[model samples]
Target: MAKIKYSPEEKKTLKSMFWNSGLVFAGFNMVKMEGNAFALTMSPALEELYPDVEERKKALVRHNGFFNTHAVMFSLIAGITYALEKEKQTKGSVDDDTIENIKAALMGPTAGIGDAFFFNCLRIIAAGVGIGLCSTGNVLGVLLFILLYGMTQIAARWYLLRMGYSFGTSFIDTVFESGLMAALTKSAAIVGLTMVGAMVAGMVNVNLAWTIKVGKTSVVVLDVINSIMPGILSIALVFGLVALIKKGVKPVKLVFGILFITIVLAFFGIF
Candidate 1:
């Protein structure tokens, strides 16, 4: 069977749609999550492919179901979905259930991998570099970060969209067989953890100024703690916060709690 080819203009249009409308309507509901934005992103392609009002409506409705994933990584899924829809339109071989099933199966893994790699690793690395530069009072640091991160995302969207369309279902099998996805996920996670650790070590400060007088010798509390284990207090604080989070403490409450503690400690000369 001859494969359908999208015009350059159509490809450009789809890319624009995915980039612009990806997260515009993101929300949580009982019916669907991110469904409205997903449908909106694909509306142009659906309209172009299915000229019949009923057919277009069906396509739109088919996509307007529970859909949640990393907002950017979903572009790859969108591309594959568009290709599958086109195939269904032209060949009538693929079914709606297959399409929905593929989306449901892929969204979770894609989101997990995407969040670990892009959000935790790439974003943190970019922010670290940008912030370091910004501390020097250079405005270019902010621009550099925006440009670097934005361009990478845009390029990934464009490339993944094209790759998904070109390979369709075969791409999934190819990725699994090659083991590239797993390797990437693992490597990104390691790097992300290392970077996060570095950030915590540099950013978190816990010092004790109190001293104990023993036999006319003043021993600094912070110095003793440092001698025993540097950054132990900081590490403990981080773990404490993590435990609180795991215990269902709301983030806003945690923020205010930290603020209150800091204020009280500073006022009492205990920090």
Candidate 2:
């Protein structure tokens, strides 16, 4: 990574990207959450890639799709996308689907790592120390939280963003040079799907309280299900929603369906 050198123009573009990426929460929406910030962060690179007016607009629209991830991972993926877009313009090895698929694949795993480290570990430690200080009437508590948690995340985002660009470019170039582009794409999709399944198992919960009366005993349905295979129901629910979404179902309807089903299940003493 240290061997990678950037021209002055490249340095300026990356500097602008690092600053723009800090506005990760800007123009957030259900359809394209974080996309506006992603486009903003990628703008400097995109401008350098696509000099023509119409082509630039098309490239911007292509990137402004639904993208969601932890803010730290968001910068990383943005950096990778910049590299992919550059590849698309220069070598013509990476196409639209390849870029989009790679983005989708990287987001989940990177997000899980980022959240576990930053949100779960760092945030708790920072808050605990900050709370301890504030309780002792030290104004430094609030500032400490900002310094430990906030500033740390900002710095991490910047580092990961640059690393993503440098590493992604080198990695993509290697794959192309070795004629393993398709293999790598397939591998990435496999890993992405595996991560999604793992997330569903860890995060999704089906709180089953139903019991069946056997001849002389009561057997808990959830326990029986778990015995057969743990979290199968959660996996099913997640994949089912994914299938529906692929079939063009809107997210709002799915949310309402989940709410309705949960309410009905709760009323019947199952959730």
Candidate 3:
């Protein structure tokens, strides 16, 4: 990884890759997509880390953005170049230590923003805002969603590229360690939670199939329960699922269990 500085030609190749790959609209799946692209693009750069083709392939698979995985290589390349240049100037040439340092320093920060902002906040913001407007069935809603989604993505590319170019070696220090990161994370969390609230109201599937009759008045009972404990139920459900995952139950199994319960209860008019 020592000789891994982006030459002019390499920069051109990577810039093209970034722009092209960033056009993908896989929503929440963007993290995995970005990771795959990073692994492919950074193969040449990662020769020292994974010298053998088989090893590299394994790394590509292992490093792929599975659950809780997110790191974008294109942006990290900027830090790579900065570190390499600094190392070369200090030691009279670039070496493996420089590349390893770049990887060590940038990996955490990239994963943080790539996972939190790009995959979670940005995707949710775009989809939530888009769906909110689109549900109105007006031409304005369609236009607004398209414009907002496109602008957010474009901003993502621009900011990532700018951070890559400007901070290079110090981007992580400047972005993550600064209060800005906390503020942004908090803000994004607020927005995402709000969106989740909207989604529960608009999208969550909890059927109230049973009814209660009192003195010639028949009312759907589940609706009353839902209205009384909407937020609490949502929080409990999320924590319960997270606990199951922590207890080593697979995500697919959890999904199937939830679906099964929903179906069974709905069938018995008890949902």
Candidate 4:
């Protein structure tokens, strides 16, 4: 198979495409979240690929359909799609349906993996690190989180885009066959869980103010609980919120509910 090479200008345009992926949700809608933006990102390449005005219009319209995935992982799809389009323009063997089918197949798996690794794992760990520092009154914590997370995201996008272009559709098989994806995800999950535990202990605070009265002697309930197990209240509170979330409670409602409860408890001097 012949390799498809990109010029320096095209490479620069691809980098712009990677950065612009974040804007995918800007034109989000019930029908086509990120679809329009995807086409917009591909506009430069499509223009270069199809010099015929009618063909360019057709290519744009073809891409303007329902397409949604994790923003970072979308770079891989973008690269692959660009390669396929290039192949179509040059070889005229690959059809539009084949391109669309490949997209449909890849998007779901990429979203699943990307969400688990980037959203659930990396994001939580970054937040944990930032919040840990913030709790200690370090204002740079927020900046640190943004810089670390943002840089990693940009790097992933750049690498994956190039990988997709270089390997084309075969890259997908190579990824799974190598087992790196699974190992990477598992390692991220372990780190994520560790950060979550640390966050619960360091960030969440809950104390019981009620006192037990016996023969005119008062015992602090919080002190007694702490003597048995430190941060028990915090852990319990975290679990309770997680249970509620699992039970389909809306996050906004849960936040308001917690606020109301905290206020009432504070008023009663029992929290």
Candidate 5:
């Protein structure tokens, strides 16, 4: 919404990227979750910015590195990257590392915002209305959900994508002028970690069912544990799994190990 105008070629490239951003999940993998989709989305921009075939190929390879975020942020990052790429090609200011670092810094915070807003709030509202309609035998509920949640996502993605492109240059310049790149990165990282901690606190639960009897009294072991430190078990369990993961433990093995441990604990009345 700036007092700005795009050239015909810029419009064409952005249009291409807007459509390509929707395929963010295509060919997703653990090693590079959305890297393929990201590369595809940046194709048009890279093609335009780097006319040389070899440079464009290198740009593609560079963009295809371990990108993952919510769909909305995916488009936003692609737009921002497009801006960064243009700067790199034109001003010789932003380098490949700067582009990558900016993407990395934005990914976490954008993911937390996107997921919470879309998945938790908008999706739930849509589902609530949709379910009510469906229960009444009206098919409009399902259609409404799609129209409400899906179309909103599309519109928002387009808007934010353009916003990123329009404002990214100024934002980057401000960061450079203020020498706030490191501070910005660290702050974004803190927000990202806070979001992760909130998720862990909400989702991970250690429901202890252990009990013991002494004389005529029965005591709940979980209560005693909680008295010592509330949610300590759950925190420990989550961190323990995370540690195992960092140690290169395979996910399948981790799942099976958890199951086996659960079964043993249940048998011992310590579930």
Candidate 6:
């Protein structure tokens, strides 16, 4: 048989697919760190009791299978969506299940790797180095920041593209069926917990209340709720919002509510 070759139309579809895949990969990398950390922080028992290396080692193929699945899935979805939106193709036939499956299958794994590699490793290292070079706010620091951050982003793009184009198309099902998914999910849970702990300790803010004294007897009492765990209240707030979201509340409405609450608290000097 003659060597099979992708036609121009297929090539175009593939390119578009990879582009969207790359965008999801990049966007998640930028935002998933905090959430991942929050998850890790809140669940130490799960992390500690995570399965051993031998099991994971056996499931190595499954572990790295997303690269292939994501590449092909995204490429095809991107192509289909483009056809639907741009070409005004048969919109009715586009099933919700297909879209949801694409999203659900990819998002969790994407968030996990994005957090570990991009958020935890690259961003943390770049920021740490950047801060260190603050005193030397010379051209060197600026150059270093630009170079490191740019390189990290570039590398992410390259790797994700490779995964999408090569592995995504070839080994999608075998990867999932290998029982590696459970292990990866567990690893993600562990990492997420650790990330969350770091966030609670670093990102969340809770401070004691200060009040003016009456007469000479200065009445001072600690802000008990805030004092116990400074970030707990904020974490609880997020959890409440998430619960609302899970119950079908719109994210836009939730955003507005969070903003309103934040502004009110700030106005009263509480937050």
Top candidate on lDDT is: 2
TM-scores of all models? 0.58, 0.73, 0.42, 0.60, 0.68, 0.41
Model 4 segments beyond 4 Å from truth?
1-5, 169-271
- Could you tell me the lDDT of residue 130 within candidate 3? 70
lDDT score for candidate 5 against the true structure: 0.85
Question: Best-fitting candidate, measured by TM-score?
Answer: 2
lDDT of 6 by residue, 1-271 (tens): 1222555654554444444444443423222322222222212212222255553343232222212223223333333223222211122432333323343344445555656766678767887777788776655666677678666565555444434434433333343567564454455456645554554566555443544478986543334455675567667766786699789887668768767977787687554
Predicted candidate 4 versus true structure: per-residue lDDT over 184-269, tens digit per residue = 33554555456557646866888678888998899999999999999898999889988997898865687788889988998988
C-alpha lDDT of residue 211 in model 3: 94
lDDT of 3 by residue, 1-271 (tens): 1123556754654465456445333323422434455444444434433456885576455434322124343454533444344433344444443333344344445556677876677667767877777787656766666666566656655456545544544543454456564453455455545654554465344556789889999988767877787555566676787698789887668878988998998888777
Q: Which stretches of candidate 3 lie above 4 Å from their native place?
A: 1-205
Could you give candidate 5's per-residue lDDT for residues 1-271 as a string of tens digits? 3445889998999999999988888778755689899999999999899989999999998888667789887888888889999988988877787677678777777899999999999999999999999999999999999999999999998988888898886786787789987776566566656655665687678898988999999999899999999889888987897799789887568778888999999999899
RMSD of 6: 14.4
* Candidate 5 TM-score over all chains jointly: 0.68
Q: What is the C-alpha lDDT of each candidate?
A: 0.73, 0.85, 0.53, 0.78, 0.85, 0.45
Question: What lDDT tens digits, residue by residue, belong to model 2 across residues 20-46?
Answer: 988889778755678788888889998
Find the 10 residues in a row with the least total lDDT in model 6.
Answer: 38-47
Superior by lDDT: candidate 2 or candidate 6? 2
Q: After superposition, how far is residue 117 of candidate 5 from its true place, in Å?
A: 0.2
Q: On a 0 to 1 TM-score scale, where does candidate 1 land against the true structure? A: 0.58
Tell me which of candidates 2 and 5 scores higher on lDDT: 2
